[model samples]
Target: MNGESAMPPLPEIGDLAARQLVEGTLAPIVVLDADLCHLYVNPAWGKVSGLPASAFLGRTLGEVLPDLQRPDDVLRDVLRDGQPREATISGTTGVCSPLGQRLWRAVYHRVELPGQGTCLCGIGVEISSLRRYLDDLETAHQRLALLDAAATRVGTTLDIETTCQELVDLLAPSLTDLAAVAIVEEEFTGAPPPPPGFLRLRKTRGVAPPGMEWLLRQLGGPGPYVDVPRGIATRHCLDTGRPWLGNLASDELFQKVTVDPERTRLFRAAGVHSLLIAPLITPSRPVGVILLGRAGASQPFNDDDLVTIQALADRAALSIDSARRYSYEHTMALELQRALLSEPRTPHPAVEVAARYLPSGRSVLVGGDWYDSIPLPDSHTLLVMGDVMGHGFQAAVAMSQYRSLLRTIAASGAGVDKILGEFDRQVAQLGLDRLATCLLAVMDPGAGTCTAASAGHLPPARVRPDSDVEVLWLPAGPPIGTGLGGYESLTVRMDPGTTLLLYTDGLVERRDTDIDTSVQALETLSLPADGPLDDMLDTLLARLANGAYEDDVAILAARQRDAHD
Candidate 1:
């Protein structure tokens, strides 16, 4: 022991001046003996515990204040070893204060008095306010982190439903036990805003833990639209462009805000005690609202929580709006692509034709890929497949230009090589900004020969009646709009029922792998045996362009009448 003699002793307990010093101090002070029984306590202790000092003097710590949380073992050791110790302690001891809970940094020192044995003197400084400040600071940090997460994870696609699901997924299992996203439905549909009253909300997404989905859905989670009245929380969030939070179990505002009592009953039945409805609104317009809920005993949403959700909602709203616009444009592009590559008419009836156009999957921009079949007076059918190198609405418009130019030039009875030669000249003369790849095949059923030419495009495939597939290699000149023409034509004899498959590069050109490899893979495909040309096209797409293509695919399949059928 380091100089037990050097340690100062406490004054005699009966000394009036020593008692006055202890009583005058604001800090709670207590003295306990070797048996851990309170030998003395100050007036400050009485003020905090709401009891007289006499109540604790002769009592053990647990017997007098069992609710107080402290390091009991450390206190006992300090008394036993005559050493000093420090600990943090806190509790709500049924005493009223600003915060029902109280906290303290307590120091315990072993004091020895003359003739009297050693006792532990414990002094506690309240630190409840500082602890609360740090707690609030940490909560704020978490909220900003939540917002950053929402910004990164939401709006990952151009799909409206997908964006809604992203928001719901981010909210649930983090800020809420159950969550849903609703939309105004017509906000992106060009419909005018509805008049004030009850508004029908389209459920975009509803999510909860695996087993709780059904319960959430019963509370207007997802699927069929929910019609909300003027005073309803959802409507309040939407109309006012603000959040509406409530305690469904007891909040009187629920009754005051709702025109229908069934809404309140629905919440009660769903066992949702706390609910927060936040608006998903953009500067341009209000998109919709989101609902966050907590079940029994879960922490209710607070002002800080509400602020965090609103920030998340603002981000989600912008993402949803962007996705909606992209979706509309993507749909329009697909429709236009389909229309341009519509079913090729049966050229001269002696030739069968089937064409298909598939836009790049999940791409917001449209591509210019087209196919056509034109009958000439010389009893030949001109089959065309072309691709514009870039993607956007402008590319689709340029593709129409190329398609129309091919038909107009083919009507003059130009050869396959001449048609491409002229196509290049006009594209350059017209100053079309996009470069293009074109493949032209002229089929003569009487001669049983197919003359094909290419302008910087992949070669065509010939599937013989015996199921042998060959890649027809022709001289590929510069792409159109390059103004460099070195076109060449190759004629291959077609046996009866032979199919010439002309397609854009998207059908074969994949990401990462070599172009020649994808082309070689296409030549080895086993087409459906003894079926219509349409089935052959379907088989080709299924085998070659398995899933979403990185680019648009245009396919034109043609064959002269088979003799066996």
Candidate 2:
């Protein structure tokens, strides 16, 4: 057909000639009369649709294959406008041999018959296999992206709960409608599981649909531990160390895992149709179980999904195991440090004292900050504050050793400088590798005097009744274990109502600020004029290192007593 006038129709051929052309072509072809009724379908059309041409001929396109109505409408438009059109339409067609589905790209043209007014002709190619391949490729790419993201999104910290939360957040609203992680209580405390009465499961993290969170909470809230019952899916997974895939459609199987009738009812009310519980297994043992569910119209868990979830569970198990080990070591070190840093000796009634030792926050390992008070022979008192260079068990051990040696040397009648010098020599002689900072103060109430020395430590603060707080300016010395023994002492009058404060750098050190600035801030603190020594120390600590301080802190404050009191 020519473009001009939009009505120059084709030179119609005889039925034999049309049949010969259509039968020879591999692509399916169909012809329709002006009324849009199928007049002919060739052998190729019969092969593609799996229907004999007799079944299609003389029938309206919609009546023969309703799924093709939209494409047929496009052909009608081409016939009405006297134009040629090419288009692709995709959907299930019952006319196929297996009666499943097929995607097709077709070209339609308007033509005139010798006797009839006009007709529509179509040639289509099946693209079902190619479309399926493309869809599968896209799905594979998405799965790869998810696995790649899990590497960074999960296990970002050495905290078990935080890691579990990360895993749930990554999976929910993406992989499944509901996701949760349940770790054994024994994993946290490093203790054996109690009897069934105390067999607890800690739901560390979870996510669910809006308004469905209550159902998850009913199962078990995220923070607190809950008792594991006889036949719960979590219990089975943990005991067997194998994944449990459940089709919630089966009432028996669903009831077997739900432990309670109420929970079963809730599960059905929430429209949960499928579930998967994967054990978080490590090389040593199973640490926990990851529970995933699909609700409403969400797709059921398949073999591919099972493989992916197991991979995620493996990664989470490793991180949780590492955190558990670290927690055990941290607890041991903290206990040892606390034991070594027992309440300082109350040397004499003439000198009232108050001290505090706080371990670092969870993000930091326990360190070697310690304080002590040793009574000398003649009512004199020796006070010490020290911090080892590193953190964790090694530093704690070093701190305990240093504290014992210092007390031993001070009790032998050595002066403050000699005590520090000897401590340094002994630290080197013992081949102890870690360095430590220390400050020592010798107070004699009868003499009304105090002498202090330092080993690469911050200067102590002195508060007098009539004067502003002052930072004692002692000569800075190298840290112990250096064997560079030039320790010096500074003597200052110790009048009644005067308070001496000795503390570790943690009390006035922040990574974001300079050490001098933090020290100056501490030195400028205001103390209550008539407050008790403990009250005054508490106030100073509140001002300097609030509870959120990053590192461990140790402070010792001593106030000289009035002769009348």
Candidate 3:
């Protein structure tokens, strides 16, 4: 501020050249003395930091940048140690022009003036763009992880409630801020209408003041009513399957629909300026919107933020679509599979029955494997386990038809062999050769006898209550629908405490592994020969599926109830 030109403008080299290079590059430039005072700042500094050159001149770093509020210790360390400090410092020290105040990663460089009496020089670079990209990558990776986990978790659960609960749990950590997933029941015609149960925030994150629910209800308007003002983001998301962004004050669309003055007050109180919403569009129609609110002095959502959040929402939409489809198909398959499974045949006068079925892993197919235990009018019981070829809706359909046919045949007073023959003939007649295979058995509780017939299905294993495993080797006839000639059935006497294990090939046939080997492996597991049929079957499945089952299975276990015990 004093002697002009006495501080000779040296050759455009050394410190001068460096300053010229920084100034010409369009980045803010600052020269710091050893005491951290602002010796010189380029014109670009005023544009970026929003501080006029006259006000910034000759001022101490702390005095000129009071908004930064950087701790005195940090400055002392930088000055005393003569080391350049570079970090993404937040808070007031991070303040910039009104436009650049959102988020920024700053890079600081320090170089010592060797012969210039221990003075130091420093510079800063803005890296907010780079940080944004990295954030986007991380968000995408997390969304994919959620999708994979949902698929696995949903596959194992039989009930929709459990599946949805598991899905919410999986999404919690990533979308921790998600308010809730309300099941919206809406009928969409040509007109766009609010979903029934309009805006029920089922789950809330973060803090909640008293009457938060009431507030959200007031904001959303009374349910079953018409004329709700849609936010800019909401309208855009609905009209086009894309996201919408409007800066806080400039979003005129939002003002048009805000009916509640209290809601507006609350938004302003929370400093919420901008809104971004993504609709959960399924293949059928738009379901709901995932809304995000950003409140501050910062500008509204930008192109990059819109694209990034929309990308995340798109993945969520796909996942939601997949989950809905999987759930619907799974429910249908389960109901059909349940129907194919005949009610349990009482093992004795005082018998109890319980059973469990598991389908294949998370694939597009719902397998054709099934089981049944039907009470016969003749006082005997019919136990059957069968696996039709292939896996999927078609396979399941074929299995259902065959199961119905088998039931009818068994009910007609025919022997197991006669029923199996009829089943094969029917399948062949229907041209379902590639879609059928089955085993049928008639158990006489009074005689303690089992007459079994198979069309290339797994043999029933008879386990002796006294630790001896009777591996039955009844020869299997050609699989049903193969047009094989009629076959004879095998009849064997069952001891009072004997256990009969009926299972689909999926239980013993693993990819790249021999069926006999897997069967043997199952036999080796220590399963009690005389127990509750359900318990025995459970142990069998647990032992067989040592890790994971690549195919679906149906298991039926029949054991004489111990009269004395």
Which of the two, 2 or 3, has more TM-score? 2
TM-score of each prediction: 0.82, 0.78, 0.62
lDDT by residue for model 2 over 1-565, one digit each (tens)?
0111111233553455754575677887777887777777767766665666666766876676676635666777897798799877666554543324577788988887766668887888988788878877887788788888888988877778888899899888778899988787775465456565545777788899897888788876344776777677778887787889996557667766665655677778888889898998898887888888899989798788888788878888898878767777767766777787778888788888889877777543667888988888788889899999988878888888888888888878789899999999999999999999999999999999999999999999888886368888899889999999999999999777888899998788888899988888765678864678778877877777655677888899987777787
Q: Which candidate achieves the best lDDT against the true structure?
A: 1
Task: Between candidates 1 and 3, name the one with more favorable TM-score.
Answer: 1
Q: Supply the global lDDT for candidate 2.
A: 0.79
Order of quality (TM-score): 1, 2, 3
**Per-candidate alpha-carbon RMSD to the true structure:** 5.5, 6.1, 8.2
Model 1 poorest 10 in a row by lDDT: 1-10
Candidate 1 residue pairs in clash (backbone atoms < 3 Å): none
Please write out the lDDT profile of model 3 over residues 1-565, one tens digit for every residue: 1111111233333476664575565565565555666656666555555656666656775686665534345545666765666544333333343333333343334455534344434445555556556776886676666656555653244433444355445443344222223223333345466554233222211222233434344445554233333443444465467765545654354554344544666555555566555565666666445555554544566675565555555545555555556667776777776665545555445233455678876564676877777777656777878787888777877777777777787777788777888778777788774656677777786777888887787787877877466666676788888766476788899888787778777677888888887776655666776567777777777767745567787777777666675
- Which of candidates 1 and 3 is the stronger one according to lDDT? 1
Q: Residue 171, candidate 1: how far off, in angstroms? A: 2.2
For candidate 3, list the clashing residue pairs, or say none: 68-92, 68-93, 179-203, 272-295
Per-residue alpha-carbon lDDT of model 1 for 155-219, expressed as tens digits?
98778899999899898878888888878766425444445665877778878866667655566
Report the C-alpha displacement of residue 333, candidate 3, in angstroms: 3.2
